[model samples]
Target: MSGSDDQSGLLVLGPLLRYVDETSASVWVETREPATVTVQRGTDSASARTFAVHGHHYALVELDGLQPGTTQAYTVAVDGATVWPEVASPFPAPVIATLERGRPLRLAFGSCRTSVSHDKRGNETHGVDAMRAWALEMAGQVQPADPDDPDLDPSRVPDLVLFLGDQVYADETTDAMRAFIESRRDIDQAPWTELKDYEEYAHLYALAWSDPANRWLLSTVPSAMIFDDHDIRDDWNTSQDWRRKMEATSWWHGRIVAGLASYWVYQHLGNMSPSQRAQDELYAQVLAHEGDDELDFGDLIDAFADRVDQQPQTYRWSYTRDFDTQARLVVVDSRAARQLDPDDRAMLDRDEAAWLDEQLRGDVDHLLVGTSLPFLLARGLHHLEAFSEALAQGAWGDRGARMGEKLRQTVDLEHWGAFQNSFQQLAHQTIDVAAGRRGRAPSTVTFLSGDVHHSYVSEAWPVEPGRHVESTILQAVCSPIRNPLSRNMRFATAVLSYGIAGPVGRLASRSTRVPDPPLDWHYAEGPWFDNNLACLQLDGPSLRMWWVTGEVHDGDHERPRLAKVASYALDADGNPPPREGTVSKLRRRLRPR
Candidate 1:
């Protein structure tokens, strides 16, 4: 049903335990009407009511007066009706999970999934949605886990899910969305029959979230997401030139405003921890209400979107969370915090850069920086960006700029290297963290990324000690949870990048008397391309990263299975000495068949 068609219905987001503190935590959701949101201790009939809040569709039911390091079952009640089922699938309903000090965390993260029906396959081009498949298995519906293996419990789930980017595609709306558009507007228009207003965005969200498996997953699993280019449009914020072109378009303004505004309502608000949301202007207003009255945030949302598009520095697209002393996760918004000026271009503007620098703290066992696009591009791709940037600035003039523009338009080469200044700044930050400038050196400073339609891991060699250099760091990229790479483009990228780009970049850097990123800073742990899902586990001071994909044999019966595509582990010794060729070969052996 369209979002407008179903306004009065149950929408439960959490017993998701966000911002869990010594005694209280916040639970948030979007509901039809203001109702009494309740949290209980055990099952649906549990007598211990943790907390209750009234009126607001979004509730932060702070479970105050609770003991720490304890496990308790919780449920939500609206107007004396238990919203959560007594028995939840894959496990038990209102299962008791704990909050304790110094626990190991398992985080599942991926991006670029389209909202399609779980029932049918319209085209076999890219294959089924990897996320829905995974969620299905987790729900004990499609690919149920082994029954005899008692060690596996459905009640025990991952702590949080990190969605890097492209959670929804406004440009590539689903068939259902198209149908709605076809009924309402003309497809012969310039921008065609894509999303146009809040109504459309709401429908898009419903399609994205309504999948039973993913919906259940979201209800229990707290998730954090940041937008990418596709979340708005492909190659968004590539350069000021691109922005100027878009601004001249007839529909660009409404599209951007609607995109950002809907993002605030559908995604960004849920991303913030309770404490963080309190600082948000919209949420603050939401917090003040106490009846079943509709809290209209139209003005606030519109204003916030305008301010962000006009002045990105006013708010950061980055956030950091500490997983006790074990790990620190920093999710950065690469698209929003960009300086697109050709003269002084940087991936991140001053404010965002400074904020990111501050967040790259030390002393954590593992530091995970989640940038939607990998900060470290492939050697060949990196060279192309450098080459084009140089070419654009030199006597080549319009030709050079046009070449760069064409590459960005047809090929996605606009990454960290495109904005040289910001790349250098981040490089400095990585080097400093590795050199133990922040605090005790982390076991690994891992940059987790998704967006390139393939998965790979790269390691940056530490500048030698006592040689005025920096310590080693790593970057892991997992992409396109459903989108698969075409063979021709893959081969082209390989040829243009690794084969031709490297040597050219080196020669150009030396000839022009300009510094180039060190050659020692490059090595790939994977080149495995497929529609995939990646998981990372932290065991003590050690780190394990792997990618999985579904195997097909012409029928729908073969459900998605976890096949190891690539795996990387940081040595527990707290030092990543240049293994050089060692990790690359190992990764190749571990790659998916």
Candidate 2:
């Protein structure tokens, strides 16, 4: 069913490995023809059988009766053709990693990437695709053998990967994708021949995922993804004005529907737990069917996509995961579930707001919130938010909306701060968890994000005691695993955002004309400008957050090397006993199940 006849080898899809109590694990793959999928442990093999679903070729290998807390090396065989590690391939094959139960969890996250050819120039420069960097590391194709090795090895695989958004760019495509479109339709026309419907979207998904190196990494890594603006279009749902302008176009209608539908198939479907999958109405129907019934899923997916767009609050896009007592991760969907009224706009709607409120209830030792956009902006930008909010509410005399217009044209009017009311609510919820107002308090609440193109961390401390608002909330942000901002703009954003906004914002709050006083905010960590990959290490009660970038400093090695751009640890929560303090405390406390 592919548009092209590029007969590449079979691609194995995931939730590849499983955690404890995983009775069955399903693996998906695309093949030339219907094929038999088999799984084996040690010398024993499960019966190989052809998948009866469509010859479009997908399989769900229900691997049952496997021991937990033990690693099992496995391989995939399609139509009796082995695809991975290519045996004579006892080559220390990749294993199905069982849960360690209480071991410290490692999660690697970042966003905003483009799928380009990874030949010599591209590979050596941009550090091979960010996803490839991780995969090659995993396959032991790169250096420094152990897990502690500071290289971009997929071998440095984490317990899970939380992809914060922009997994695909429907707006910007590679030369190959553009060429493919040009062959079919006119790009200089009104609809512009860019991602118009399900047919085009399917091709786009293939183009995005076909990179062999990156695809291998995704096959083995358990990934969770959320979509941002680029997944559908630029500045998606920035405001009512922006939305209205885009909706009036002929292409945007089909683009939005196809984008959401493809996202459900390619990304979100694999993210859900089996229990969650069963509860999914669309997926349930897909599972209940037994043939190549085009009528089965095609219509259902279309309707669902339309519903999500028309009624943003009807379906929730936020999900939470608790990693024992060590941490709880909440991934929010800031685009689709937005409340975009011209007078009272917000990044999230009321249903989404309520969902986030419930998810943020702190009972874990550490809380992590993942938003594609940072909750806290740079100082200058923070002041800009304050200024715009004041002007929009007519606090700045009669020229309020005019002032807001000027600011909107220049500054990014698409972040959490653009919707001041929603931002305020989120800040209060975050602070509430941090201040211990909610039952069990986490030692720290970190918001992991990307999408401003530069990476940095900032902290917010309590200005007023017991107030779970910006009065005492802290922030840490990192961005653009591969996309870096221009040097000139970086300097401008830093100086203006920090130097001027710091004083002006604080002073404006004291003007008495404002109802809710502005927050006392400052730059605590970084506006560290670079295109880099960020990793967070949470070993026991001690947490260290840092960014790593590939620098080509006269190295004899052809591959890009990772250098520590910035590093900081959060170990101030009274852990004792010198160097072993944090670990010792963590070992003593039995985590709640």
Candidate 3:
């Protein structure tokens, strides 16, 4: 379908609005076949010939040179036939809303969602999908809210939505995904039920994004995403030994290549600005190709993914953006860019660390560092992980190291705390920025993250008592927009990580050369085990955040309403009022359900 005619057979997946700036935006889509895809954004328009990746057709149409602070409802066309909006879409018309200069930034962020049936049984098993509820609420499909507790700032709409990671779970496939897999290959083989190639990955992406509620949400709201372990597999790149085990597998090569290559096409391509995308060699190749016949990106992306896996330094996945002196966001690639060598263990390789160091400066009202893994985990968890890392790296001997590696993998002790070197580097850099060593300190230096399948906010200050730190340093985590941790996991998380931090720290230090953490913090709000989505708004010097979940109102499974779980605000002084005194107190009072 192209511009004016019926748009039935042209489009397959999307016209997803991604990467919006003051005067420009990009729309991404998948087509049924090769055709010229065009985006009509009010008066301005842009088009690009669809490029083939494997057997699938796709295009990224960059719409630029538009007015700032403008909101324009847009449409998609393929080969001169208009296909988007689907004649009579139930959702609101999708729009490309550019950022307004000097405006307060409102953003919603969370990670780790599973694509499954959103019916009564699904809601009962997995909790309701928070993103879907939000979308329904935004579209005004939900029932009335509590009059006393009306929606907060009803007029406010987020400018962006940052999906931290695991937008799809390759390892934990849903029944639909498995059925698709079984249709293609034998279900009894290695990597059975797991995604193995670009074609499977494509199906996964389609399933993940095709839900009507979420598809509408994605179309209207610009989003940026990073992949977590589950996006490829559980505990991906957790350690050198983990790598060795996976590399030795017969199916590792195809799995990694497909995972990364699909990630590049489906998730990573839309993350960067137009100028940034123009610099990418693969993207440049697509733009330069000239033909009526489809241009397949199969070989190029395959080789790229393979080479990038072998030599991570050849490509950079981390990205940073500033919002006109209001806030600066650094979305880090914590998974792929790792220094896994035993003696030189680091979560961030040297180059990645250097890039992060440069991005951690002050001057903006807020500094947001987005990572899939939480930087400031609970104190006891932090100490234990650090201790495990030391033990695994041979603090005692080879035999001890072998046992430690097993323990580490079993416990999933692979966050920042596990990589003491990189953890300390970030801690010190953040401390410097908070202490005004970078520039005038921002109001808050916040680490926005997800992966733990719980939502919480922890406030921290320099461990050195006399340090003159002005800015608030906090870790705000909202995980599992759909996936809720099992009851056993909740118990394990609360008991092991919430209490006994003092003993854990002492034991870790005694066992090996474990350096003290740079900051000490307490949970200001929660470790709520709810399927949730969280939003943060920057108002002048104060930053406010709230978490919301889907509530199945009176047996209305298909129409769950958005319900607030928690809310907190950092004052102009960048300090939250007394909330929870200790992590143990949180565990006792707000025990996970």
Model 3 alpha-carbon miss at residue 480, Å: 1.1
Ranking according to lDDT, highest score first: 3, 1, 2
Q: What tens-digit string does per-residue lDDT give for candidate 3 at 110-180? A: 99899888998888778889999888888777743443454433346789999999999999999999999
Q: What is the TM-score of each candidate against the true structure?
A: 0.86, 0.84, 0.97
lDDT of 2 at 287: 60
* Window of ten residues with lowest summed lDDT in model 2: 584-593
Model 2 per-residue lDDT tens digits across residues 1-593: 12222324654343143222223344445444555566665653553333322123444454556565566666766555566544353224656554455676677788887666656665444443445554554565554223464533444557676777777778877677788788888889755645677766666767666655556555555567788888898778866656787889877878888888777776776666667766888767756755543232556677889999999877766777777788888889999998778676678887888888888877776788899988877755655666665565566666866666556645655687667777777766776776677757776678888877666666665546545531123455656665555556666655655555666864663352433423445554566665556777666556766666544434423344444555656664613222222223221211210
Highest TM-score against the true fold, candidate:
3
Q: Give a tens-digit lDDT track for model 1, residues 161-237.
A: 78889888889877888998788789789578677766676667777776655666666665778899988888899
**How many residue pairs in model 2 have overlapping backbones?**
10
* RMSD (Cα, Å) of model 3: 1.8
* Native-to-model Cα distance after best TM-score fit, residue 491 in candidate 2, in Å: 2.2
* Runs in model 2 lying further than 4 Å from the true structure: 1-26, 32-66, 85-92, 123-128, 144-156, 291-296, 389-410, 465-474, 505-524, 553-558, 572-593
* Rank by TM-score (best first): 3, 1, 2
lDDT agreement with native, every candidate = 0.67, 0.62, 0.87
